[model samples]
Target: MSRKTVEFVFASAVTTNGTFTVSYPTGYTKGDFSRGVMHRLIALQSTFESPKGITCSFGASSVTVTYKGTTTIPAGSKGIFGFDIAGPDTFRETDWKKQNHIINRPAILRFVNFGSPSTVSTTALISAATGTEMPATAASITYTYATQGGSSPIDGANTDGKLYPARNIVTTVTHASSVPTMTVTHTFLDVNGNQAVETHTTSGGGTSNTITGSKAAAQLISTKIANASTTQTTTGATLNVGFGSKLGFDIPILDSTQIAMEIHDGAMQGVWRGNEILPFALGANEVGTGGVLRRIPAPINGRIVSAYAAVEVANNANNAGTIAISIEQTNSNGSGVTVAGCELAFAASATIGTVVSGSTAEGAATAEVSTGNQICVVATAGFSTNAQFSGSIVMRPTYTVRGTLAVADITTVPSGTSGDIYGTYTPAFTLDGSKQVGLLVWTPEPNSNGTPQYTV
Candidate 1:
């Protein structure tokens, strides 16, 4: 699917603003996600010239854009559907500056190069060697030796009463003055602490007084410096400690272990199956009391943003036959004059599915009677007394040619007659999400006979 590119504009009463330009694209094809993101980002930039950028998350239907910085538009302009723009009292710095206070014009800074994406490596390596020399003798002989021309390597020779004697020194010589040999071989054995090793070599006897200089064909050394490094490492556990590191300096002062917690494995487990109640904070200037945020349990299905139910009943003077009723319903977040809407209305017969008597149900043979009072559902402006809207009602009733009264005459009842209907209605209104709103039902008071008579 392609992404949709939506353009944005800010309408304010900034008179001095030289054509408060709205930067929108020439056109956009509906499904471009990238273009959509870019559009929001640019809009955010336009709102807060210092706006770093906008972060966009793609949902099933729409993309959500979160502005990094606070957008200070005219006072009331920050809401989803705001009519006027105004600055917030609390966050004055974030409030849009008045035309007089517009000391500095807002400007957007563009980063030349954000960075690059990810990838792999492509280099290679090889080995190098000089040359190899052959040994003089094929036969291998072992020789013992001490640290070359040095005293005992061990320092603590005497500690207690008895002197700790060092291992006796020993030397072995293996050399045969054969045909004038060009190379010398020497074998050396070394024993130290708990480790020991033996080495062999053949060398030419230099025509000198003592020994000839010869290269040791092979050499081995065993070292056992008393070290318990392996024993110390029972199990490899890493302890990370640094004051202003990953978690910050404050973590050291906090005991995260004391907090209650639950762990989840990587599996297909329902996150929250049942109801989860949450609270929201209310503004200080709110109509009702404000303190901690209040919470409402989440519906099994979902929350109802808006819902409306309307029932209309039609009746006559005799009130002996079935009263036709039509019900109009709307879901949560239903549209008003400001937004689009969808409504469903079921006619009178289907409105009341069934009726029951003492033992049997009412069939088509039995006509549904009207209840004492009629249910009138109507819309009023602003829910105020002065806002009551008036309109005419006309019922289209059908009748046979041989009928005494015409169907339209039988069904239609002109409104505005006193004592004919007994009901009152209030319009639907909206309160803030954190408010405690309620419906007030009023019934007419009765006279001496204890029977109430209501007049329109």
Candidate 2:
């Protein structure tokens, strides 16, 4: 009934200073996973992985891992790569520890379509940082990207709070050099207090500029680029590439494309048959008819961000009442606090309009919720007829910048020329990590409607 969960443990001390790689069984089915994504990669390589920023991705029929942090992933460091993405119920994680030189972290993975040679291919993997950055003189224009709070923005996943906690970052530039040259450098600082740097410089001959670069930090890590600059020197203002300049300038070389992705861990919503009996039925408006209550729990520590309702079956024209959907927090005393802004309301006076309706507010004080807390759902109308409905409450991971930057080889258009790559912001040149991330859709949940959808 279930595919045996698989594992591949290293018998010897495996080193990941360059890049570690492994091949999966041919035609293997990775269930529902967003694999080969840098930000989506999760690891326990070192006691503190935030700074390490371990990235995982798949390529060449194999998975690769790139360690971005400076600290050595000590032997015995667990959860080096969370390969348990086979099924919805199997998103597993190991405890985090402060051990040094963490090595031999075993991978517990699950998969389908393991054809012949049902084992993983352990190729000699080299661990290395992604390449990307630079500087110049003569009253030159300078731009420095760093934490606005005077700390390191990369020091996240610091569970014990031993590392710096500055989240907000900013950049400043000085304008002066004639026929000035643009220099950009991204330095990867490790927990060991060392550094790995990438540099680039290009000839500049302008007077106005707009340069923009995209960082892989999740939605929570919105960066600020300020020209807290020291006024320019000459007529050449070349920094103005494009406020929204197309993201380019591949360092080392542009061998791949950088994708922006976000994954929601929970949908605190559900569907219901509005024509059912008493409590579940939509008699009239919500004033008297107690709407059906579905306690959808938050899977992780997150905030109630959005809410919406959709009528599957068009309601009668007489249904003039409004439908209000709310997500509440259940307390120890069994009481509920309506999460502010996490509610949805729509006029049901007309027939089914769009396939879906309503939205939610995010990051409210009352909107903050914990794991396992109930996300109660309620719906009502003035006079509801046969209006079948479905609703949802979106909950994203609490941490902004949900995933690490998978700074892979720029393989987009032109492979790239052997020259410095300039940028408006930062780049810690960690290359592509093709980690063995597998997600399966086996044991599909068959619904009464005769359609198939995976429900976790």
Candidate 3:
């Protein structure tokens, strides 16, 4: 389909810094233009000055412009912004047909600012002689972070080692057919090279399907961590989603504190998934009880890849003290292995209410600990007066995957003759015992008698 150009002209006066909304022409929806296309068109046709700190974003039927600076346009000033809309092509078509197939696309502009009152006028220019309408039929899937548990406070005095809470990832599927069954697959590795796979299916006579993380699955994950040997050392997992015989997409997962992934076909058809790292803390006062230690349990059977320590101290008047901090790990039998250490000193009469922080990397001779080993932070203080302090140690573990896990599947045909399948495979580990998780999503081609696979 050919691209259509639409222009919008607004004559408005702004007396204050705020946001303004300009609605698109009638018949055109937000998803009609992809983010990339909108950005390109805006960069080409936008007359709004960036020096004014003006930034704009496109929505279903309108554009919201925000002025970050204190600049104001004189009354009756004209602001022109325009963009070209061409619906997704054959391969890119998400929820709608080609751009040429859409008719009655309207350009409507409206002023939306609670700031000073302003008057504005708008006009739309469409380059099409006639518009065409096309039928829309597309299925979609979405994912969200459901809930997470198993978190411990980071206060400095907790000695009991606690396992990280089990996490849940949820997804929803919407289809046009009744009694649609969707299959989801999960593949993850423990600190050991052991890979586990879980699959679940749900179907009913409804338009929407929701799959929640099962308690059994959570238990399985926890069990894997507990069973990890001292030698196992892997981090993260590989994830993929499939739609029976239709298509599938691979989602990315990595060693980040928090990550979010979104899959979009056009605008309306897509999925979103994300994960977050829980935080830990501890606090204490007085030199005697002021020493604090924190431990991070191994998620899977994996060796420590790296370790670091951070400590903060607050001292009162007449307090002369020295604080020592170290990162240590234990063997399976609970023997201690010191990985790194640092020391902080406060002088008497140096200053009242002085705060100090010390951070250090692991010693050069630091060694990696095995799975089931406890990695900890230990602190000691010698003081003549009162002092308060707290600290935490973080250790990253690495592991390998023994085998592949098929996480998701969809069957377009009743006999399951035509469908999509998604799986994850672990590659070889690096010298540090770390491996990359692979996501695979593919569908069998019908003409090839289901022999040829098409990857997405």
lDDT tens digits by residue: candidate 1, 236-328: 111110000000010001112111211112122112233222212222222112111122222233222222332222211222211111111
Q: In lDDT terms, how accurate is model 2?
A: 0.32
lDDT of 3 at 373: 51
lDDT of model number 1:
0.20
User: How much is 30 displaced in model 2, in angstroms?
Assistant: 45
Ranked by lDDT, the better of candidates 1 and 3 is 3
Reference-based lDDT, each prediction:
0.20, 0.32, 0.32
Off by over 4 Å in 1: 1-7, 10-27, 35-52, 57-64, 75-237, 240-456
Q: Residues 381-450, candidate 2: write the lDDT tens digits.
A: 3545455555556665543222232232321211112111111111122112222211111122111111
lDDT tens digits, residue span 209-291, model 3 = 54543211112221111112233211111112211111112321111111121112112111232211213333444354544
- Model 1 poorest ten-residue lDDT run: 121-130
- Candidate 2, 242: how far from true, in Å? 58
Clashes of 3: 39
- TM-score of each candidate structure, all chains considered together: 0.13, 0.25, 0.24
Residue 295 CA displacement from its true place in model 2, Å:
0.9
Top candidate (TM-score): 2
